[model samples]
Target: MSGLTGAQAADLTPIRTPAAPQASFVDWSGGYLGIEGSAGASFGAFNFHETRVGARAVPDFKTGDATGRSDRSRSATTAVGGLFGGYNWQTGPWVYGVEADLYGANLKRPVASTAQGLGYEGVDPAFSVIRAKTDVYGTLRGRFGYAFERALVYASFGLAGANARILATEPDLATGAVSAARRDLSYLGFTLGAGVQFAVTEHIALGLDYRYVDLGTSSRFDLGTLPGPAGGPLSTQAGFTSHQMMARLSWHPGGLTLPPEVDETAPHDPDNGDTGRFSLHGQTTFIAQGVPGFRAPYTGPASLIGNQVQSTTTATAFLGLKLFEGTELYYNPEFSQGFGLSRTLGVAGFVNGEAQKAGAPYPKLRSNRYFVRQTFGLGGETEDVPDGPNQVATRRDIERITVIAGKFALGDYFDGNVYAHDPRVDFMNWGIWSSGAYDFPANLPGFTQGVLVEYNRAAFAVRAAYTQVPKEPSNDVLDPRVFRRAGTTVEFEERHVLPFLDQPGKLRIGFFSNVGNTANYRDVVGLTQAGVFDDINDAAAATRAARRKTGFYLNLEQAVTADLGVFARFSNNDGRTESLSFTDIDRSISGGVSLKGSAWDRPADTVGLGTSMNELSPSHRAFFANGGIGLLIGDGRLNYAPERALEAYYALSLSKTLTLSFNYQLVVNPAYNKDRGPANFLGTRIHADF
Candidate 1:
């Protein structure tokens, strides 16, 4: 469009190569996504025609004289910033691609005009003002470029659209009265730009572009003038044109590669494998949830009430180091704050897994995990492990022994269900994320000091762990006497490839036992019967002793299709003893399906729907019926029913490293009590990882 012929512009200019080529040039052919910041000025012309107005006149008002038309126009400048993504197809030296971007803008201007003695036979005086603003804009463009080694110069042209606000106000100078109208309009137009990019690395490029955009005029005549005899219908038209100078940074995931300058012959570091010697990653999650209204009989120590908003936030940094052959150390430092609904109480399956029971006004930082993992390959088939948080990309034997020790969550080692593991990116309910009744072992923040041993074969694996639990029920401090007061778990997992579905699936069964100072539900009942303050909670204090609680759970995850998977979990814990940690449920069953949005052209997006039913054992129910409270669930009195929960969520990938999700939950018979009603929770979450 700029006058150069297709032959001259799209074809790369021939240039002589170096006498002796050292390395191949950077490849610019690939899909790229990036964030960019831009500062620019938008020029806009707004024209307002005072065709007819119903307002009081100054000296006098004549209908015909007031109907006369008047026009005023003005223009101004603004700033903008946003995100863009594109893919390029390279044939030889020519690159062609399409890009899309959205930006926020602030381009506003005001125009005023005064007419003295002009309306009624040069006797009426009036003043008119118009304000115009452009709030948002986006573009879709096709770009063509020719590469010269590590640099590319390109031109782009695109369709553009914008949202604008127009306000027109007129005041009769003689009457001190005002008439005003406002209109919001969507305008469509075109844009053209040119830029040159220089590759800073094989995968990263920086560039600057100068773009010109023109948003065609939007006219509205339906905004009737303010109430008055001299005010009628008014017409307003606004147009915008802008020149932007934007600095852009682009990251090509497929283009990340090693530089060409490395030596041909160098000793390889054994510990690094293919992922290098050290890795660092971080993630931040923020969730806000609330219930609009729910039925409740009476509020107890732990009861969900109607109309409440609760939010939680967590940020974590993962650091990994390769220590020696088959050995690695990983540590995670985290900061968290805020509380779940009802201070993380009420429901057996409490919402907001990111929330801790003890929340502080300010962020609380803790060493969440520090562990050493050693793997011994037994000479067999291998599996590839991709680089991720706390993990180094590498290959390991399918038949191997893995030893892990230090501080970590027991969930990290056992009863892992693929459909609902990560609260930051998947399901947020506690019961669904892990086996609710298993109560594997953890301090207040859901971590423990432990050692784990795993033996893996081609299609089967066995794992066991011994960890320290809290010193007392629901306490945050771990018991120092790990051998005396500890938690142990064993699990077996079998992997299968289904014949008809041609998909992979896993079935895991686990058993867990925790020895700690805990109270017995029956003993609490007995104490209450013996006039121990007439409260079951008081009976719990009188019955505290060193006890063992045992539980078992079955977990299954089956991939039904390439983009669809289903998971189910069934767990039961001894109901005689009070819950030492985790939720109040003694028996639970949960299942769900997860689907990838590849069918809709959004492969990174995910949707999940799940339901869970939790029940309390007879003694546990009796305690609650006698006004007793466990860790999370309680009601003044109980008309017992299974705590049933249905959860659904849709997670949208904003970028490779950012995701946004909307979650909904429906809970019937919260806290296993029919008196307290069905509650609905709505939540929004944002997660970013790097």
Candidate 2:
């Protein structure tokens, strides 16, 4: 409660000029919605007692002794975040409220295994592992508080709930083969906490909060058949307690306040007083996809199962603030969960572009992008910029210089295609949405820190950027060595109008180079063939050294009519060294057509159809034939053929901000193996934006 006051000095600074300070009294009554993040530690104890079978008693697995009782305790530090909402009532200096929140937590112990150093040597051991975790928890609380000017002190008492689980994996007693068992319990208890908040603006407040929670002892849970000679059913009881400290930022829309002004006759244009200083936007996308059985002669480590269904969900908040004239800062915080089909393997041209390489068992919060953008006008015609995600409404010169720095996806700048750019709304195939052969540098989530500069004129634009790559292929961490291990890219774009049809079109050419610790496909293959290593992956690891990879791409988009557009991309890489990021593609070409449904009186709807072909280089194919696996695709042996995909989708717009799409894809020779299948996939996507 000790931060700066006044609406003008809040985190989101306004863009207007000259307003004397006013409003000394603050009001704290409203319904509020916000995000809260906490860090803390949890401590708990578990007691397990074996139950005898008809003729035998289970060995005390927790300990080597014969005693049936096993008691142990564990503590873990964790970080949790989620959404919170509540309403408060204020009378004089007293304020009371009731609040509820749910959070995904990483509170669990490491797996305890009994097979350490036994070197059963690649054979399945007749041993077991035990572990316990709490994945999700929430609370409903009643609060009481007192307000002093712009600050509030409060105390809360609540009921807390958690889903607690224990997992035990072991080998079968009779066959000495692997088996698994699990038990789950729901716990309910109480929580108590206190906190303070300082109102930074009439509708926004920043606060720090603390709470202590206790989930009382659980009833004995019975875990099914244990695996040893004395195997039997096992019962266990556990209790949980934790303390957390959280930072919160809440918006009281119900108590909205407007700045003092007297401009009823002002023009609503950028030169006048129309645009706001800050913009808030959000989007959520959920995709469900499935594949039926296909012809597969044999499966390898990265092979996609015959039949499977998977889903992924992502939600992001786009917050932008004007820092100074012609400059803005934007931050995008996202929550991602779920998995891709076959754990995102077995496909060079993956079916789902939205599927991330990293999967999470529960929703995880991450700051995916945060950056600053500055624009300098170069004395030319002005154009209107609409309000949207990461962009605020304003009028800027058509010819200008812009500089952007921070963390973001390179695709956001390069590979421009109006008909096949956004996967959530358009094409869903990676090869169609982007140039598959260009190994753009990125971490697992497809983002990197960099500086980008662009020069724009009425008919052309030139862009360049230098960005960080991952520490290793498909790694989640970015390398910090800048020039020693980074990526540099440059692109030139030309805008034109077709003479015959009088339709507009654009052509883009881009070149990229990356320097990193990489291995040559031919070198690694040679090492494996000489018997220096049994595995091609191990040979590649041993041969990794400073190497360079380069590529280029050509992209074009043309509007044929008022309601129809077409796009195409052709890209190729050197294919000498191993792929550092992106997928296993050396050369690719894709084309697509998009049509608006205005002919059927549904102008907001869209239909698209696209096709792509991806090929691997000769040496790259030989490496895979020797059982080398890249980031996404390898099937032990190669019957090599070009990976081809055909995709079609129809999006039905439910409203201005919501859409439902149905998609179908046919993949020929999945992962470029002629012996395998022409796989078919069906998918649905629900997308919302505001």
Q: Which model scores highest in lDDT?
A: 2
lDDT of each: 0.76, 0.79
lDDT of 2 at 689: 68
**Candidate 1 lDDT, tens digit per residue, 545-625?**
889999999999999999999999999988888777788989999999999999999998999998899999999899999
List model 2 lDDT by residue over 335-358, tens digit each.
765567787888899988888898
What value does the lDDT take at residue 155 in candidate 2?
Answer: 93
**Residue range with the least summed lDDT across 10 consecutive positions in model 1:** 56-65
- Which stretches of model 2 miss by more than 4 angstroms? 1-268
Superposition-based RMSD of candidate 1 using all C-alpha atoms, in angstroms: 17.3
Displacement of the residue 231 alpha carbon in candidate 2, Å: 6.7
